[model samples]
Target: MRVEEIMSTPVVVTREDTLVKHARDLITRKDVNAVPVLREDGEIAGIISVSDLAATHFDDKKVNDIMTKMVHVVLRNNRVVDAAAVMVKHNVHHLVVMEEGKVIGIVSSLDILKTMVD
Candidate 1:
């Protein structure tokens, strides 16, 4: 299967200026592990994850303050195995899925595991 086949779509994203508390709430409500931080011009700036939030004490701070600037991404057309490889190589749990230079979805390690189980 392809990354797009199992990736979560309609990605939930956040702005750099968004409050940490808000981002955390968004993640909890959406049941996602992370969200991509986007620039005003719609480009990806960084990423914020549940682990990032949990490791910090800045609920009132901006998302940018705790976001990981180096975001790993996978093309939507890539194979699921390729996505898993990226995750393993980067020691990351999630990756932003892109298509035509635009954020389209996200894939997590758990997603890959679910595919294998099914």
Candidate 2:
């Protein structure tokens, strides 16, 4: 299947200037493990994952302070296996799904795991 087939749409996103605490709250409140950070131009700037927040001791840090700027992304039509490989190669758990340079969805490890399970 393609990445779009398994990716979660209507993903929650955060801005670069958003406080780390707010990012943490989004994760906790939405029960999501990560969120993509978008620039004002609607481009993917970075990604903030649970591990990113957990790694920092200071809660006052901004999302930009802890967000991973070297975000890996996959096109909607790319094979799900390709997305999984990127995650494995980078030791990341999520991949931002983009189309025409705009954020559209997110693919998580669990999503792939479920595909395997089913």
Candidate 3:
């Protein structure tokens, strides 16, 4: 199995300059636990997750204020085992999936768990 084979699709993203409240709304409405943060040029700047949202209370803050800068990424075609290893090493529940240097999808520990059971 590969990352893309099990990753979540229709990835929702938030711009770095987006307000924290708006980002939270996007996450909530998308019904996802996390979102990839994008730079002005469409590059993956970092990631924003529930944990980040929960850790702050600044209504004026932007996504860039709390998003994790060190994003763990996996190629779309990478092995599931490799992706899992990266998750464990970084202690991250989610990873940004890339294809040809573009954000394509996202894979989380939950996705890996489902793969194991199936």
Candidate 4:
């Protein structure tokens, strides 16, 4: 199967301007481990994960301070196997799914597990 066929769409995302507290709240409310960071034009800017949040270890820093600017992404049409390999190689739980350079969705390790099990 392709990433597009299995990936979750309309992903939960965060804006660059969103505060750390709000980002944390969104993650908790959505019950997701990570959220993709988007720019004003709705482009994929970066990614903010629970690990990234915790790595900051500062109560005062903002999301921008902790979010990873260099994101590892997969094209929506990519093979699920290729995406899985990237995730494993990068040691990342989430990969931003893009289409024409825009954020389309996100694929998490949990999603991959579900694919494997199903």
Candidate 5:
């Protein structure tokens, strides 16, 4: 399967200036593992995950202050196996899916497992 086939779409995202608490709330309400943090120009700046939030205590801090800046990404057309390899190589659980330089979706380790079980 390709990444686009199993990736979660219409991704929930947050802005750099968004409060950590708000981001946490959004993640919980959206039932997502992570969210891409966007810059003022709508460019992806970083990614924030549930682990990141749980490891910190800066509810009032900005997302930019805690988001992981070195985001790992995979093209939508990439194979699921390749995406999994990237995740394992980087020891990451999530990857932002991209198409034509634009954010399209997200893939998590759990998503890969679902594919295997199915």
Candidate 6:
């Protein structure tokens, strides 16, 4: 299977300037673990995960203040195993799936494990 074949699309995303509280609410309401951070140019800037929000005692921050600066990206057409390898190599839990330079989906470690099990 390809990354796109199993990746979750319509992923929850947040702006870099978005308030941390709002981002946190969205993530909580959506019941998602991570939200991809986007820049004004519509490019991925970073990623804000549940851990990022929980790491700080202050809630009055912005996405840019807490987001993981480095994001691992996988091509939509990449093999699932290749994407999993990227995650392992980078020690990341999730990867942004890009198609034509645009983020279209997200693949998590859980997704990979489910694929393997099923």
Which of 2 and 3 is ahead in lDDT? Answer: 3
Alpha-carbon RMSD of each model: 0.8, 1.0, 0.7, 1.5, 0.7, 0.9
Instruction: Name the better of 2 and 4 by lDDT.
Output: 2
TM-score per prediction, in order, is 0.97, 0.95, 0.97, 0.89, 0.98, 0.96
lDDT of each: 0.93, 0.91, 0.94, 0.85, 0.94, 0.91
Tens-digit lDDT string for candidate 2 (1-118): 9998999989999999888888999999999999999887778889999999999977788898889999888999999988889989999899998888788999999999999988
Top lDDT model: 5
As for TM-score, the candidate ahead, 5 or 6, is 5
Instruction: State candidate 5's TM-score.
Output: 0.98
lDDT of 3: 0.94
**Pairs with steric clashes in candidate 2:** none
The stretch of ten residues in a row with the least summed lDDT in candidate 3 is 58-67
Q: Scored by Cα lDDT, where does model 5 land? A: 0.94
TM-score winner, 1 or 5: 5
lDDT, residue 26, model 3: 88
Candidate 5 Cα misplacement greater than 4 A, ranges? none
Off by over 4 Å in 6: none
Residue 60, model 2, lDDT? 82
Error of 1 at 107 (Å): 0.3
For candidate 2, the TM-score is 0.95
Clashes of 6: 0
Badly placed stretches (over 4 Å) of model 4 are 57-60
